[model samples]
Target: MRADAQRNRDHLLAVAGTIVVEEGVDVSMRDIARRAGVGLATLLRHFPTREALLEALLRTSFEELTARASALEASDAAREALVSWVRECVAWTTEYRGATELMAAAIDEPGSALHASCVTLRAAGARLLVRAQAAGEARGDLDGDDLFALIAMLAWAGDQPALAPRAEHLFDVVASAVLTGAGGR
Candidate 1:
């Protein structure tokens, strides 16, 4: 891509990321182009599809989450690290409107551009989960997949305006139920 085209692409991605966080993934492409001061055709030339745009917008965050898991392990105890990572996962899922739903779909759909990112996130969560289990901080029966689902549920609660006030309560409940001897730890 030429320098000018690359600049346009970067601008579009940045604007789209903001809009998705404020509005939703379902926001129209035309509106994004309008906000970015570009034509819809130009946007399509860069992203081609809404999924493509979403994948590009969130890839960095997903990668960071994976990296954060490694960093957290070195700094925090097993239980704290797992819980903190769960909190971070919820934050990521709720950072954008409809992100919880998007992540759920992305995790299972092999064809989705965000699928690999989702896989990496699952691995990160699993890494923490293993540490917690080894330390007897989490239930031996629980696995990374379950932890991922827990974060997803918490994020779902966070996204519901009516449920936002109870989001913390929901997180506590899920975390308690998942961790052994935690009692909402």
Candidate 2:
């Protein structure tokens, strides 16, 4: 791709990502082009189709999230690190709601890139969970799948702006339950 073409692609991805998160995935491609200061042909040339664009956006986000998760120090205060990572994950989910939904939809589609990314994330999260459990800071019985499910639930709840204020409380409760063996009602 030419330098200008690459710049246009990057701009379109950034602008369209925000628009999709604020609006819905059904937002017009022309609008995306307009916001990106690119022609509709340029946008289409970069993304080809709406699903293609969504998949690319989601893959990029998931890759970034996985990298962040991998960079977290497992040897630190395990409980605190886990809590902080969960909070970060929640923030990402809330900030990219539409893209996340598209990712979920993509996971259900066979041979989708999102499904592959999900698998990678699961493996990395499992490693972190195992390390925390080994350090006796987290529940021994809690597997990666369980942690993933818990985070997904929290992310869904945190997606609502009205529920934003309660996220910390919810995170605390979950952390206590998973780490300290406190019974969460």
Candidate 3:
């Protein structure tokens, strides 16, 4: 991409990210273009679709979380690492109002724009879960998919105005349930 084009794309992504957090993933394309001080055609040229724009905006975050999981994997406390990663994932997902639904759907849809990122993220979490389970820190019955579902569920709760107040408590409950004997040590 040309320098100017890349700059425009970056600006649009930054604007879109803020708007998505404020409004939602379903916010109109026109609104994003207006907010970015660009024409719809220009915005469309850079990101042909909403999903494309969102994929670009969110891919970096997903990669960061995945990298965080890797870093956490090296921690001596496996259970804490897993819990921390799960908390981070849920927090990130809740940042984008409608992202949890998209992530859940994208994980199952191979052709979705966000599929690869979501899959990699889930795999990263899965590795952490496996590590914890191996150390008898997490429940043996829980797998990556279950962890993914837990993330989505927790994120959903965080996104809700009513449940937002209880988000922390619910996270503690869910985390405690996932951990094994005596809070999985």
Q: Per-residue alpha-carbon lDDT of model 1 for 1-185, expressed as tens digits? A: 89998899889999999999889889999999999998999999999999999999999889899999999888758898998989998987888879888888888899999999999989989999999988888888988778887888889889999999999888888888777873657
- Give the alpha carbon lDDT tens digit for every residue of 26-133 in model 2: 788999989888789988989888877877776787787788777785346665567667777777776766544655555456676567776666566677777778
Error of 2 at 151 (Å): 1.8
lDDT scores for all predictions? 0.89, 0.74, 0.95
Task: Tell me the spans in candidate 2 whose CA falls farther than 4 Å from its real position.
Answer: 24-26, 105-110, 181-185
**Global Cα lDDT for candidate 3:** 0.95
Model 2 pairs in collision = none
Worst lDDT 10-window in candidate 2:
98-107
TM-score, cand. 1: 0.95
User: Cα lDDT of model 2 overall?
Assistant: 0.74
